[model samples]
Target: MTDRRRFADAVFRGARSRRSLRTPHAPLVPRRPPAPPAAPSAPEPETGLETGEPVVFDAFTADLGAGLPTGMALLVVIPVEQGGTPGFRLRAVCCCASLVEFGDVYGRPDLALGSLVAADGLLPVDVLSSMRTWSRTKKGLIRWLDARRAAHGDDLQLVIWDQTGYGIPWELFWLERAPGSGRSEGWLGGLVTVTRWLSIETAWGEVVRDYRSEHTCAGPVAAYVAAEMEHDVSLFGAYHLENSDSLHTLAKALEEGDPLAMVYVACHGTYGARLSDCVLGGVPLDRFDPRRFDRLGPAATFVFLNACHSGSLVDDAGRFRDRALRGFAEVFLRSGAAGVLATSGRVGDRQAHEMADQLFRHLRDHPGRSVAQAVRDLRAEMARMTPDDLLDVDGPEGNRRLLPLLYRFMYVFYGSPRTAVSLATGKGV
Candidate 1:
């Protein structure tokens, strides 16, 4: 066996032994009452679109395996009190098996992870390297996941259900190099299909909806691009908004127009504590109410915020807030978006546009691939591309190499992992 295999074996053995000796902890009790049953699943009446069978969004239960789809595993990270001190409890559950690790205390490193990701103009590779090293040390949590990933292979979909407000970027966790595999090391997001979820109350209060059943890639698309990005208008075809500054108009349409399949925005995003302060395409995010999305019906409206800090959530002190603030991504999800693809840090304009192009092309080419899987594949694809492959080598200095490497890790997806887009033609609509 290789050294990596040996290490994994040791870790697995240790985990099993630890579990055997300790009593399994009780399930976490929900602070609020269980959410109401979701609207009954029904077929699309007008469009004759093949709306997949409806699946009710069940209330959050202590049983992680309850309602979990086959071939998908959930890694739930909850902040809990351990021995009168604050710590995190991690549970990895799938159809075949379940693993639980507790007493993983939070530290400065945990808090700093978010800061490093949200920082301006840092090399993404360096931040990813730091995350990888940190993952190695968390033998109880990350190592367990590594062992599970190795055992389960690449087909498993890892859904990170993180309740910890530490701003832990779970997707960036680096798994050790596979045994005997010549491929270089990769982060968790690149290696497997990953999606994220928060509590129902936190995401959309009293709004119980399953994005998988409601959302598909084959539908009308709405886009909000900046004036400078006019050249990229061909990306969305006829769906691109003519006036880039009309984000408010787009928001109104999303609220009142026909159920759109996807909402794509390519512009500048500023992160701030208040909703009014956080701006997307020069329009404060506060203008796009979650209720407006709630009115769009059950069609899975996936939003792609292709801008810097569009996916970030921070506080006045610039640290990851423990509370779930209604940020850009959250508002959409809460308002009933099937899923969201956003960036966690500052991204180069050219790189962001390229990432957007590659993403849409991938979804269009692969009709039935889930958004989560597409993101995973994209991350892997980007990781394999060299600086020369992605950029003009002689064009610029500074971040020529770093931007390509960094941008891949910046994307953070929020929503159902099973949500997919099906474009019969080149247009997103």
Candidate 2:
């Protein structure tokens, strides 16, 4: 059998054996209070057996844990077919532990999940606040995370490796409050530093990167700002490329062997029917193919695509099924960028600019914080801020606002959560 087949078989057999041999442990701490029951509807038929217990497989663990640094974990989700039914296998591994669980089979497409993505690949923010359906897969993953957090501290950094390409928006998963814990429940992304990765193959070696080395220092930045936002270009203190000619300028920078610390793009982005149609800075995304450029420049550690829908990975059907049509975030990641921060949906123009400003300011002011940690802190801060505080609005507008909370979850980071961007001097990017 091929390597892929062999690996899958081993995982399946190992999961079964492990489940049979070991008794599941109860949570060490009190479980979170259950969410209010949803409106009753016809029950969907089960497609496969549910195994909520964590399974340990040595081969899988070793492969995933080979180069994982301490305090960091990889959550691998792969779509699979068992007995002609489509399902997913969820696995997580850190330096010291491993856990695997089988997710519920997909008998039919999830309309709620599909509703998050619009026809143009942009997310409809209105659907976010009312979302109640939590997939069994998500719940199972949460249980695993709860156990991990209980054993370890909440400082763990998570790298989600999603082979399903469904664009599940893992960061926005609602976390319930632990009873008497005194911690308010919030989005998972705000609670922890989370990043994402996508690999076609099942092998861990194919997707592993040495993140420690990339966390050392901040290098030169290359900023591409729209004409209207030229005022923000000085924030990076790097070569400023106007939006109209950003493509050419970026190409020249790559060809000239310029070592860049960061590539910040502040422009308008629009989703199209296909990946090629997606536009950034008035240029088609197809023009920025990483393969066309000989190099992405040395130390190209971080990319901040501060634009609407720049981070989305969906295709024509508003789903992430078309792997070949990946978004700008994936493009930069494949181009050897250590980390990328982009938006998953439409963002208010003012909020988008403010978000970028806050991010850079936080990075510069706090020299020791990692990009992911800074993002997490910022999300939490935004979540706590009322509209009156954030937008300086009056009581009526402030009480009826949703953008502050919604905008915080729109920004998604894809890379090593622990990868630090040093700005010890606290001066420029």
Candidate 3:
């Protein structure tokens, strides 16, 4: 194995659990997405940041895998599109000793997140079984996972590496039915914890990651939004920045000596060549190097990229170019962030606000909640939301129902599944 693979193996080996594994039931399919409507015009500009007390996090006491599903850890590798053709696949190196599964699911070359929702909403039982079978044969790792889970318990960390910008909502696999009734059950975040990883080779080297970082707190929690997103930024109680310099300064401080719990960024995001062509204030992530903010103190750091396509990794041009990185989220990870919450495709202001509200509220209400668990809660909350919950905007009121569905599986978590922030302690779990 190469040095990067060796590093990944070590990280997962350190996190390997000793619990019994049970095979998962048939996988579930995602809820079908609604037909998309015309895109909305950009919102007006407004700027200012609302700074606040630093959040306290109890890293020493926080359990890395507390409350997480206990089962064989799973790593999946999916294919990305390049120049309208499928490119070499990205693989998920395993941390679980019992099993490491790899699969190749094809995605479009353009990497545009066409629909956030599933096509059928509910996949049939036969299809679910077929999926597992296909994964076993085509991907060549599911059978071992099944056997391990059957022997142990039905819980696994489903780590996904979507370098190609495929829009598959892996969370919606339909697993089973209610014992007596026809009522069907699906595999939402409640049952499975989905974490994303970056697989691009950079100038420094291959960006192999350590997904198990202990939580730590540096100081007070702070937030920043692009000038245009001041309205949404205020929802998170964060001050908005007018340009990239201020954002860079804060990032620099976090890397050097500043105490920062979390940074919320709301701005415009675009995808081409790669994901995260996002502009915060007047600064584009392309011009901003996240590595400049390395060694972010003892406190674990989080970055919420509340921008459309901020996490999209569509184009494959220059993917192997020496300093070329995938998206803003990857940059943050490369720079030293413990975790990042970003959207896979275009997301609206309303949806982004709803996500932020859920994330912060969960952190505020539940001290020491693992970032993975909080995100699990967030995914569950989003799954439960309906169009009725959204405010009617420019689109057809009937079509508005799709908004919540569109947001489903659009947001991805990059970093340690065990990493979490506590507003109460101002530290990472």
Candidate 4:
């Protein structure tokens, strides 16, 4: 109409001068977010577990979370391994200077192991000193024991403690005195350097080194519970000692076993709830059959009780005495026994040969540490240390120095899971 109103006001002034020259003058600062890279301190393996012992065994692989081995059980005093060696190599079995001279592991009876102390003595020397009882002849314990003398047979017949050239040794015990000066060692450092344990031994070197690295309760939880309790062992029967042998051949080897044959008992441990019916006359017990040739109720599966007070319980005083010792590990995991490794009192002899040579060298190099990942890596390395006095099963000093050695002594169980994974990490299962 006048050139269309001057071309629509020159297109609105050329689009507002091209948006005011793209609107920028002197004020615009907003762009942050990029600061999170500072967690690389790196120093937590102090020979704890990457397969420990300064690593170098070869063949048994299992890089870390390890796996393989569906069966297990191993107790040691020393038997470092030889004969095609694929894995398993740890041996300390007390020599770091043995201590506990309470003496006489029974056989003399009527409670005299120093007359249950208290003559003004709170010292078992702060306990947990050398712990590794028995295992010297091919690492003794039993079950096919030697297997026609290894050298190559895929060896199976349990119990080994044949130490080669002995390197880790010390102590003989008689130190009837000595308990001062920053605690030097004796009476387990006079009961772990008391002052009420110097602020928990000065924070146990930063919570066993760096507040227990991440979790799975890490650190060789003793080598992932010694390779899941020594992977894949298959014993049939013959484990009676002087009741004149013959639990009917263990029930004819639990009735020609192998519907998954897993059970090992070195013998004697006690405490109760149910499965204590005279102790290890054992197995789906209510009576006895041992399988007279075979029957295995929940399929019979795994069980191992290297004896010595099978995880000690019972302290008497009525009203289900702490529910009969916490229902003795839930009636052996509800009697079908898929896992059990007892021993809270009377365990030393070199801590059962350093816990059966680091549990068959961590299951010959972590063959996936089976049978419930070897007691949950020994109950998470016994619930992260802090014992030096272990076995209080419920206290009163575990019922005055462990209730009659775990109520009538009897041992062995492996399998019947539901609770495990503690080697030293206290606070109660």
Candidate 5:
């Protein structure tokens, strides 16, 4: 009864009812990432920013449960990384160079996609985050997932992202005996976002990102990618409010009793303890809820607040509690998940993407490896490019704005594949 089974009957019906449609090829991986000739400019933080609210990282920790990995509570790195040099990597099209560097390198999870074209003939399956979109030959693929769900007696976990306008070709998963070809294949599509755009001043040759779009790049590219994966996965989403219809669609899906395994919200965060870059849902923030999972099918997992503050705890003063760790990961695990990985500080988008790339590479290339080992590898690579501030620990003391600005936006998830940490706040990472 994996999440996939919960919707199996309905999904097949949706497909069989409309099998005639044009095949949408996954976007060719971008070979050359676009770049601007000049650096970027920053917008002033909105006037409503409550800087007057004293931030207490220690207090935040008390509110959250223990069992969090060290550095699970702080994410002061946004300013650190943005203040430095920026680099660009292509979107979907994986150049020959990337193909050569596949499993062990750094890349964005949702955008810089990599996949294994199953020799048995199935559409490429997104390696990282494990989502599926489009299908040239649907039969065998459907059988495979169906069998997995029934055999596991668990809901299939569907990880979704940026589905604002993406649509999946449901017919692609149906199996059929094609002429002469005994076996059928399916095409899988996934992309990793390198450096997102705040507002593309293509006019100025600049690619930037801001708090508004949740690191969403500007272009039909994102829209196209979103539409591509609309129909598959257990529960898929890279962030909340990704597009106009995202919330609406999510509400509808939940209402219809779809089992959502985990809801990953990897977006703008602050050391002050807010999942959103700006206030939302009444508390100057938004939090994850397990009770909302009415139709989780048969899976024990619920929500994942992969975004920064997702694991951060709040002290009595309402500030972040743990200066060195965020408790959201602990909460996610304590509440229950296969596991949760979170960041204590602002993880750079590029770094996050790269980490995701390595994580997925390890998962696919080295099947059955422990998630801890995967993260270990990712951390090792990230350590290679540590910012100068982190490297110069003796230079200053106590959360230097310049220091966090140097290298804190790193992505970390803290949760057992089946465990969640306790946060009195129950913010849900």
Candidate 6:
């Protein structure tokens, strides 16, 4: 236990320092510009999912507790093996109390995660069961949290710092009600505003540095929800850069524009047991060569990366791979975007689209809200939505009712926590 504490202490110290330091944007190295992309392929036919019933991405679990006391929180960093099954040694460090614990993950972490967040191949009941099973295995961690809550009171917040190659959905962990409280078990999202962060060295430093200029530029908001919403420029007001052609062209277009506000993307994403394998659309972010954007000059201040594993990173086996490549979220920050809202893994298309739309609505309707507050409000709003409001049908669909709650917890905000969206009219703060 002493040795574990010492190790966790070291990691916590490093995380603290990195959180404090900011990495200045590296000077753009002179290089040839990227080639133009081929014309966009014809739009595919709309699937029933897209034009189907409105999917309300709810984060509520029975009684979603009022968020932890403002600013008071816990940060847990878990070490994971490469290419290993989702199961891992639970060597975690808690920043709030400087607490550290070593243990094993519950059940087949991979299977539970797949059933809960897998993009395909699982029934709604299977998904719910998988989620419950995953949470059940974490009884040890829950006990630890219960102790902390008892000691520190209910105001303490919970923020998970994911450092593993296989991204675990921390939000799914179920916390039972206090003895005789007469309430059922509740997922972590219900009790607090649960958020996640990357633990790689370079990513943290870049976030610290880029965060300073997160809202420096005042530009129009841009978006590309889907092939159908491509021409809906009014969706975001002024600029709506459709995911036309390819991601390469989108990057090029944003590059040409002066310092812009934010770019929103909604598309299929893929992740592997390895964090480096994460991709947005069809482009792998880790393998993305900085040289590709070398000549680009547009600076997008913030991004809403509504893709799987876009905010994930693993500590390379050793110091050798410490900062080898940037995490998917950091890729945008390094490319001049100061902040990002990303998911740790694959999310259903319905939930993905709902998150994108609601996020924009909150940012637009409430300019006084910072990005963090906007997100919190968004989470709370969705959590507040009753089951009736979210359900289209009563019986069979109700079995999968938890889908909305699952997605609500998948989004993890990266970069400066205080940074908010700045619209072209300069209203959003």
TM-score (all chains, Cα) for each model: 0.73, 0.71, 0.61, 0.23, 0.32, 0.61
Q: Which stretches of candidate 1 lie above 4 Å from their native place?
A: 1-61, 80-87, 108-125, 178-185, 200-208, 211-214, 238-245, 287-290, 294-296, 314-322, 386-400, 424-429
> What's model 2's lDDT at 301?
57
TM-score of decoy 1: 0.73
Tens digit per residue, CA lDDT, model 4, 65-124: 122112211212211222322112322111111111111111111221111111121222
Clashes of each: 4, 0, 42, 85, 112, 8
Whole-model Cα lDDT of every candidate shown, in order:
0.58, 0.55, 0.46, 0.25, 0.26, 0.47
lDDT of 4 at 305: 45
**Residue 56 displacement in candidate 3 (angstroms):** 49
Q: Pairing residues by index, what is the TM-score of model 4? A: 0.23
lDDT of 3 by residue, 221-335 (tens): 5555655556664553332222232566555554554545666666655544432334443456567644455443345566777766556443333443332234677667665
Give the TM-score ranking, best first.
Answer: 1, 2, 6, 3, 5, 4
State, as a TM-score between 0 and 1, how close model 6 is to the true structure.
0.61
lDDT of 5 by residue, 1-429 (tens): 544333333322322211011111232111111222222222111111123333233332232222322211111101111122221111111111111101111122232111111111111112211222222222333443333333332212211111110112211122233356333222111111111111111342322111111111111101101232233221223222222234324423443332333443334333332333221111233343222323321233333333333333322113332211113332333222334454433333334444444554564476444444354444433433434243233222311222222122233333222122111111242
Worst 10 residues of 2 by lDDT: 27-36
- Ten residues in sequence with the least summed lDDT for candidate 6: 34-43
Best of the candidates, TM-score: 1
lDDT of each residue in 1-429, candidate 1, tens digit only: 755344334322321110011111112221112221332111111111123334232343345565656667777665544334444546566756764534345532443332453222223345555676778877666555666666567777777766544567777777776567543456788888888765443433445345334357445667777776665677766453333356776777676655667778877666555556567776765565344564334666778888766775433223323233446776777667778898775565666777778887887688778888888898887667744233222222322444466567678888778888753334454
After superposition on all C-alphas, the RMSD of every candidate to the true structure, in Å, is 13.9, 15.2, 17.9, 31.2, 23.8, 17.2
Error of 4 at 168 (Å): 14
Model 2 spans with C-alpha error above 4 angstroms: 1-62, 81-87, 106-126, 130-132, 135-137, 180-184, 200-214, 237-244, 290-297, 314-325, 386-400, 423-429
The whole-model C-alpha lDDT of candidate 6 against the native structure comes to 0.47
